[model samples]
Target: MSKKFLDDAYNLNSSQETQDLYQDWAASYDDEVAENGYATPRRVAAALWAHLPEPQTPILDYGCGTGLSGLALHETGFRALDGMDPTPKMLEGAQAKGVYRNLKGFDIDDPAPLQNGAYSVIAAIGVIGTGAAPPETFDLLMKALPKSGILAFSFNDHTLDDPAFTSRLTDWVDTGAARILFRESGPHLPRQNLNSDVILLEKA
Candidate 1:
């Protein structure tokens, strides 16, 4: 068995460190998270589907580590899915799932890799927060959406406790840039006693 990395997931201090950690953890990510009862992906996918409710609508699963999020989206009836991640090893796992129409890998330092308005609905499930993508990533995804576009994502208990993370969500809503369509807190990794907030935002 591989050494467990989930315990150190939130302690990563840099983008390179984060990428390297996923590279090593990619193979066992699904199994380990499943063992811990990972639930955010399903919850986020359902929330997004409830608002969009269009299976054919194209979705970009940004930071789609290992395609678990993509699988959840597919299970919710979404078919036109594209995924992007910074870790190639993680992308390999995602590719094996065969759910995304396209999967791409990007440089972690590439601040604006996504073409603006390319996806009507972009998901960042488990992408942002303490040890993952930074707060500015929320801005990047929001900027990539066209008017009335949707962004569905999650913030785990660790992230929700940080003002830096929650403030980004509020900044967009408070500034009239986006509107909250759905926000619910529920199980994330039930076995670990973790919880997360599944949030959906429509670009205004």
Candidate 2:
């Protein structure tokens, strides 16, 4: 695969564009991202393990793409994992992992795909940023949660460089809609020498 795949991964303009892009990338998405030494999966899983610790609580792997993040959660001993993605091909890849109890397909631009109070924590690893999910999706996820819901996400160097992402997170914190439980910067993709901040927040 050419580096253009990596370049095109971000830079998306519409829901159709994102669906088409992932559909094409779904088969090799795991290997391609693995080359970058994708670290967010482990980081997000660790954050959840540290804070939540309940192995049986329902967890939704938002933007789960190929079930990579869900697999990580399963490996961390989380059994009630469910995954959601917009691309069916990617969902198929996830299904093959046998990690999630359920997998659904839904566009992020649409309303929250899951029912209210469906999950105790939403793990959004390597989902939003650059050419992918918009920051507005974050608000939607927050709204989908019941009180005390946990939202764990990560922003790579590419995404965090955008001041708006930083600003949006800060605004959510300042407004008292959520409180930051844990935040730390660590390895993201060693090949790119990039780092990301993994954050865990609770709904107020």
Give the whole-model CA lDDT for all candidates, comma-separated.
Answer: 0.94, 0.85
| Number of the top TM-score candidate | 1
How much is the lDDT of residue 97 in candidate 2? 96
Candidate 2 runs further than 4 Å off:
1-4
Candidate 2 local accuracy as lDDT?
Answer: 0.85
C-alpha lDDT of residue 72 in model 1? 98
Per-model TM-score, in order, reads: 0.98, 0.94
Model 1, 1-204: lDDT tens per residue? 578988898999999999999999998999999999999999998888778888999999999999999999999999999999999999999999999999999999998999998998999999999889998999999999999999999999999999998998889999999999999999999998999999999999
The lDDT of model 1 is 0.94
lDDT of 2 by residue, 1-204 (tens): 353366687678887888889899888788887988889898889888988788898988999999999999998879999899998999999999999998888765676566877776888898878778877777767777889999999988888998767777888899998999999999988887889999998999
| Ten contiguous residues with the weakest lDDT in model 2 | 1-10
